[model samples]
Target: MTEATVAIALGTRPEIIKLSPVIRECERRDINYELIHTGQHYSDNLDQVFFDQLELPDPDHHLQVGSKSHGKQTGEMIAGIEDILLDVEPEVLLVQGDTNSVLAGAIAASKLDVALGHVEAGLRSFDREMPEETNRVLTDHVGDYLFAPTETSADYLRDEGIDDKRIHVTGNTVVDAVGRHRELAAEKSSVLDDLGVAVGEFALLTAHRAENVDERDRFAELLTGVARAASSLDLDVVYPIHPRAESRLNEFDLDVPDRIHLVEPQEYLDFLELERTARLIFTDSGGVQEEACILGVPCVTLRENTERPETVDVGANRLVGTDPQTIHDGALAMTNSTTDWENPFGDGTASEQIMATLRQTHSVRTIQ
Candidate 1:
């Protein structure tokens, strides 16, 4: 607490969203920190929207690495991060979630002998085929402080040979951000008005997994399923299309149906508001699934499986897969199902819990 002593490393939108709550926590508690953005996603659309929507301070450094093969991109980030880290010389380098950016930053810090803190440390899809799974596992091994988002995540670390003393069940900061921003969502979102959606009268739809978008027919099938579900229920559906999904729609000649309002990508605040009013939501995003569960909206996951089984266990979500009939039936069942259930991700004190871990791990360590 003697000086601002943490550096946050991020690149993409998910890292931005998950880390924003941690940055805000530092600010609130008078913790000094520097934010470093590795430009793995350099598009202003991909990265800037999050900074603007979250109202984060301009990053102290941006690598501007842009797009490349994952190995090349991550290597570029490691070199750039090492340079900046050498200059700022913080007590701990903080990386969030499981992106190549986080992986690169952790590698940079480990080589430099800097203490490392990882936010959202223990999520796993058990699919090493995913670039993210590798990132998550590697980061956990090197982190001096690991802030796991759930007890499930903490248990994952324990099973993986992580010392229990180094891992803390801090809950997910997504819940912290959602809890903090719910009122702003109510005040700023016009999504409900634009779609003529009354309270509890609509479903929110989103689907952009690589499997759904990278394949032409699969992408069309996703939209088609949502369209069918919206029509069957006679409910207005608001879908804020992701760019990947939009590009595939054009490639596949998919139609945006009358009942399905294909809106622009929403900011974090508006997206939370949309989740709040949605009768049921459909998506393949793990973060959105967690958000919807925490916001008291029943969610139909548009994928074969979810990494966040805790939400399903708590009765807040169901995996509906890509079949149109399944999407429709799942949405209908969610609409009819009870939403009054406990949020297993804790009561939004993740930031405080994380700070406690950092305090215990940090001392007069040698500066980088």
Candidate 2:
């Protein structure tokens, strides 16, 4: 244990949740690691609360880079990150999932000769139209170690000419987070009671994909479909409203109905509690797809395709494109389906597995 182990970077809420387990791993193993936050999200709900709730150390460094066009935002982060790399110069750079920040971090590290380990690597929708697909592919290509969340995602990497030895099928970290938080959620959460929804009496719906949110008709249609679907079941539809989606909701003059409860997005612990008790879930998010699967709740994905094909492969989720009939029918079907899914993601030890790989790859550890 001569050299300090790694430098890890993340910018969004998902990154925080996924990386929390690994940070714990670093502490347990006495591995020295630096956490860098890029300030990409810049929302109290999305970023700040995640840090405080997860007890993630105040980032060793923060860029405070506000939002910008995709290219400029990413380029600015790349330059700033490269400067930081020049300073800490740790043995490995650990990054999470597909986002501009992760892509920028990978680019900076690769150009500077830093070894990169991509957590939540190898996921693909195979649609270049999706920004995430590009981010995942490019990041995996540069990563020295790749942690795949499912067999399907691993196969995707192998097909793309990734080094077979570099990829490991460690399960999704959302599942890890779910397992780590369930009891605490049950013990601490009152979302269900506050919403006045009995156990297993509601469908949790969350949709804020940029593709759907930007088009007024598309946005109106999505809410209309949810209103129709949830109303049909006589089930409560609890939407922890996303701010971006809220703006769109207003711009489209879409009045969120009484049945469709629009509320502030809950923090990690509360959201997981809602997921645990939810009868079903509808989302345009990759992370929610994985979370519902881990909790054994049926999911209707509003997106056309999912990167986590394991959910579809296991019959735990159904993809319904933004068409109103398709979305309505998918949600209705999910209400009746009683399928139980064994989590494809590993057994809540992805962080430990990631650290084990880091140790093997970099050969170093020190607390400070």
Candidate 3:
């Protein structure tokens, strides 16, 4: 196979974390690739800190397309990516997860007849109301290669009429990321000590979904539940507030309980260490759910449905809606339960498998 020029498009902290291993693999093999940042998450905490901590190469191109309404944001991203795709003409375009960036990259690549690879593909929350669901579904359909994270995700693609030959079950890259950074996180992060919390003594909490935080009532219920659960367990809760959620809390005039400490977002290493050491986790973020499960920390999801059903199936997580009572009960149960449940996401070689498959399947082209 000849060498291929690849382009990876990503935005947001989770995408960077999950795609780090793949980027490193490209570097190690001396592959010609360009990293493009959509600026979907342009904040220092949400974006720049991750690259510094994960040691990823600086993005070759940054669109600086900050947050906007879904239609506008996605359209802008598609236009921005199309221009780059036209200029670079990479043999393949790779995108991960179900963000607007992923959807835009898929659309641009498909229109240009570039072979598109969708990592973390075929995850379905089955809730059309969720924007992420729509993005994942569309990207999966348009993709030339679907790198599913599990058998369940692969089955979802097959059911959607995607060719089996294009589907590869390469496990979640979260596993690869966690495996690579856990030890480094423990050594370097002092979030636990800084917060004055002992290992296995605090409950980590985070809620950032628009459905949960944009609505006053729902946000109130989630906050109440977190407080109730913390009070019941006699454990302090540490919440790294996402900017959106923080603004909503102020807009709604909702007050968090004293036991729930609201802090700014931590760097990747600090956040990873927090997840690894926490006694329990309550979150509305899918990436956090995966991280908690990978770290053997019991998780109570603040949403009614989850795309990562493997976490629930393996008994590592429970889905409790934003209802106060349900959230409280779910957290209580998870806190009291054992974390002996197996991790369904495979061992840390997912990046290796992804690169191998890409190399074998695509007609390699040079970087020039």
Candidate 4:
């Protein structure tokens, strides 16, 4: 039997972290796979640090798309990816999450002979305002393989008319990532000491989503609410601010509360360590919601809605939005809640399942 060739395309830190397990699986099995990185996240803290910490191979193709208007960035990625797909012509092309990079890869592969596989499929915030919502919806429809992370997500795909044959309920890779990296993070990360905070003593904050940070009023409210919550809880708020959020904060001339300790973005292991040890976490990031749930940390989502509603259903998270009083109340409630909520993601084998499914399907296609 001929070795199946797989191409994995990713951009952004979350994609890198979520997809690292699959990349390692390919190496372990000695599968022929190409790593195509769309440089959607250009910052060293956001991009290179994850690859270094994850010990992933340098990308075979780096499309330096960087930051542009959504259309411009996706258009550039489509061109670059289409060129690579033509050259490598892999049997399957894999893209993870709802970034513009994922949409571009799906669009490129759909026009080619290669089968498209979307990892972390069928997530929906149902808010058309989010570009990610559009990306995920379009990618799921175009994908030949929809790797839904949970039954709820699988149901979302079913309701959208995706065939059951194509929808595989593989657990979310974030669960696998947290399980695989938790011990490593504990051993290597000194974020607690570096930040002068102890385990279970500080609340972690990550609010970078445009919906939360792009608007001056919203950004101010989110910061004020989180800081107030932290103050009420008698805990320091450690915010690892994203570059975009930092720019917006300065642009808006918003006053960060004295209690909110703003720091530069962290590497994956360091951030994972923080998440695992935090007393409570507040974030607008979908991936953070998943990680906090898997890590058994109480989370208060700063968004109005979440794609990962499973986190809320499992009692692992609360959607508090940016209202100061609500955020304070929600934070108090979550901080007092039990951290024993079962992880809704999976039992840490998503990568293996995803890879096995690809191999079996590719082989069947070959034989037919």
Model 4 misplacement above 4 A: 1-4, 44-46, 364-368
Write down the TM-score of every candidate.
Answer: 0.92, 0.96, 0.97, 0.97
In the range 1-368, model 2's lDDT, one tens digit per residue, is 22335888888888888888888788888888888889888484467777877777888888888778899889989998888888887888889999898999999999986888899988888789988889999999988889988788889899999889999888777777878788888998787777788778888988888998888888777878877888887877899987788888878787775668887888888898888888889899999998898888899998888898888888889999788788889988877787776778888888888888777766666665
* Residue 212 C-alpha lDDT in model 1: 69
Residue-by-residue lDDT tens digits, candidate 4, 259-356: 89999888889999999999999999999999999988999999989999999999999999999989999999998899899988988999999989
- Model 1, which residues run further than 4 Å from truth? 1-4, 364-368
lDDT of 3 at 249: 90
Kindly report which residue pairs in candidate 4 clash with one another: none
Candidate 3 at residue 198, lDDT?
93
Candidate 1 structure quality by residue, lDDT tens digits, 113-198: 68898988888878777677899999999998889888899999999999998888888888888887798779877867766678
Q: Which 10-residue window of candidate 4 scores lowest in summed lDDT?
A: 359-368
Model with the higher TM-score, candidate 2 or 4: 4
lDDT of each: 0.83, 0.84, 0.90, 0.91
